[model samples]
Target: MFLAFFLIGLCIFYFYSIKKFVFFSQKSIKHDPPVPIFGNHVQVAFGRRTQTEVFNSLYKRYPSEKIVGYYKGTKPEFLVRDPEIIKHVLNTNFSEFCNRGVRRDPKVEPLMLNMFSEDGSVWKLLRHNLSPAFSGSKLKSMFPIIVSCTNKLVTVAKELALEGKEFDACILCARFTIDLVGASGFGIDMNTINNEQSLFLKLRELMFIKSNWQMFLYGIHDLFPESFIKKIHISRPQVRLIIKQILDSVRSQRTNDTNPRNDFINLLLELGKVGKISGESLETDANGKYKEMEMDFNDDHIIAQLFIFFMAGFETSSTTMSYAMHKLAFHPEIQQEVQREIDKSLAKHNNKLCYESVSEMVLLELIVKECLRLFPPAGYTSRISSNDCVLPDVNVEIKKGTKIIIPIQGIQLDPVYFENPEQFNPKRFLHETLQPRHKYAYIPFGEGPRKCIGARLGTLETMAGLAAVLNKFDIKTSPSSTRNIHPNRAAYLIQFIDGGLPLRLTLREKSSVISNGFP
Candidate 1:
């Protein structure tokens, strides 16, 4: 009798949930039939594929689709395949699609209320204050920190080169970035470069634990109604407490310092002094004028910002560098091209890396650009309609609160924009040849007013990481390495290699000697 009752309850639940899944069919939009609770994400939820693979597959399968309907569980999501429609959503008609579709209640999970996650007034305020901190001049001031960290990276490469065994590139780059971010953002040497058991490494392990269960819960956040998400706190409490402690400790140190450093910590400290910020909101009144909105930079807000900065700092640059190394390992000719560029730049700067030095290496930049094409760190980006808006190209009206998915990886791989897209061809990014390509088709760092604020800084740091490795050693595919690299299923949005990017390093005969006076 009990078994029969449980089966009856489940049947009722499934039938009730299907009502929300009819959103696409009502609008006559094309979409795959959704299953009970997983919607179209059963494969992903069950760990059969990563989000990148799922979106990329759907995108290619619907070549004629201007906008394909999707479901993140019962939550309706629309996949934007056409470049013109993508432009309208991302840039031209941005305000209408400015909100993140997912509901965020900071009281329940303060850490989720970050620049990357929040929208409307809160996002605008944070972006306005954070924007100046990443300017060229500020990055120039941070160059020494990058140089010092990359030099340590080179030193680590030397030891690995002597050992002559394949090492995990993901872990290796993670260490370098941990040190750089720890020093630049918090004003402390993380010491992760040389020590495997570094506390910061342990801290990161706690911060981003990957599992099928975590991914399921993430989907559930979008799956349920806003009321359900608002009532529950998803971020780990123990993790939140540890991060808060770190934030408090750092504030104290920077506060007591006489000559404060011009770094990320100092930048945030300066913002905190202003108490609050008022900005022209992304949302507008019926008159179409942007309304004004303001927000405070309290301890909760400050700590949340710090968490994103720390997480983004270590994750993005490290993922890019690891993927870049993987490409170089497989394509020696392309690797040789970038190595020559690195050598010329280092020689020009007397074996030292400076901010200006990075700009001069166009070939190296091309390599990084192409690497991002294949393995964009974020893989995809999202937005929601704040008001009813018609897609300019398709003439389809998107209703308020409808989610728009921009598949960055899929667009980058589309043959319409790129020929032989799977081939690792850095020369495709040559300035002379890149003019005619669709601008929106290659958004490793998105497009429009809401694009990543740290694009230049992040790209520069990644270039430096790759430059350091190529400067000291040659990256080659190991005997254990395969041509077909598997994406890590548990890495959430990061395009992590499953077993890590394994590559062998050999000391370069022509490497510029880093003596005592290089810096």
Candidate 2:
């Protein structure tokens, strides 16, 4: 009798799981056929293909369709291809697709409660409060902190150039950005640029190396948010303990301070002192009226924000700078043009790398923008519908809880929108050239309200770091470097180079030439 009952239950489960494979068929939307439990993401789930590759394949396959349907396990997902649909999802009908749909149990993983992972009311409130911290004035005030880090980077680059060493640009830029985050975000000197064995660097490395079992656990959690997967811990206990200890130590030192330091930690501390984060409501009631809402800004919330700040701040900026260096190495003439612009700008600033000087390096900025277009740090972003709605231009009805993916990399590389999309062309970003393009076509920092708050800061850091290096030294492709870069299949959301980016460095002869107007 027990055996008969078990067989009955197994049959029921099998049909129930496979039922979702027909989701797109019923909706009349095009999609790849899904298997029972793996859904359409079999390649990604089994590690045969990275998420970016899978998404790109689906995007290319359905050229005529505005949206392509897929499944993550049993959950239905929509991959949006039309720029109009994307704009609607990101801006026009934002209320219906506001959340990123990344649910996290605050009790199990306190750090996951950050603004980046948060949904709905909590995200709105936190974003409102945190927006001021990244304002123009605040970033300008923090410029000196970034300059100090850049100075250290220049010192290390000179030593590397003098020794005629071939180094991985990926690791080199990561160390520089890590040091910037340490000083600017937490008001601590990590000295990672000089100290190869820094504890913080080890922690950063460990965060990216997830075990196979851990990846399975994350998949389970993503597919079955209401199931027993909540009990599974996504983060390592040792890492959490170490991060908490660091936060506690820093908090204790700043608790009694009256003067504001204007750093990220101090900014959060100030917001916490206010007790609650209030904002205009994004949600409307049945009566069609918006109401004000507030969320508590407690210690856990503060720690969560700080954690994301450090993670996003360092990772995105460093990856961008590394890729920029890689591109410049291959294109020597472009590199020379960028260096000339940097020198001209610095000459006006008395040979100092200041905010005003960096702002004047237009060609350098264009080069970084082009690098981002080719290799966006966050290749794709998703949004889940909060209510049943029709997409603006396509008029496709989307059900509540359905996931929508915006393929930033695919859109940026699509030849339909960009001419010779594979070629590294910085001129595409020139003001007049950019004016005619679709606004949503190039979204490295994403679009609409949920766009990365650290966009400006990240750009500043990348340009500043590049300027500092190019001003003193020249980058060249090393024998260990690969002409064709491949993305790491195992990497998390960020698209990392398959292997480290290796490059050789040499001091620029123009470094000794002082401009007539500057010291």
Question: Which is the leading candidate under lDDT?
Answer: 2
- The list of candidate 2 runs beyond 4 A from truth reads 1-11, 256-259, 284-289, 431-435, 512-519
Compared with the true structure, what per-residue lDDT tens digits does model 2 show for residues 427-467?
88885454688889889999998999999999999999998
TM-scores for every predicted model: 0.94, 0.94
lDDT of 1: 0.81
lDDT of 2 at 162: 91
Where does candidate 2 have its weakest 10-residue lDDT segment? 510-519
lDDT digits (tens) for residues 1-519 of candidate 1: 999999999898888878888888988888888988879988777677887888998899989888898887788888999888889888998778776555467788888777888877778878888887788898888888998998888888888889997898888999999998888887888789999788777767656656555666665665665546566766567666876787778778776778878777777777778777778876689999988888777777777888888888888888888888988898888888788888888788876777777779898888888888988887888898988878776677777888899999999999888889998888887753646887899999889988988888888999988887887789999887777777777665466677878889998777776442222
Give lDDT per model, in order. 0.81, 0.84
In terms of lDDT, the poorest run of 10 residues in model 1 is 510-519
After superposition, the stretches of candidate 1 with alpha carbons farther than 4 Å from their true spots are: 1-7, 19-22, 227-229, 283-291, 431-435, 515-519
How many clashes in candidate 2? 0
Model 2 gets an lDDT of 0.84
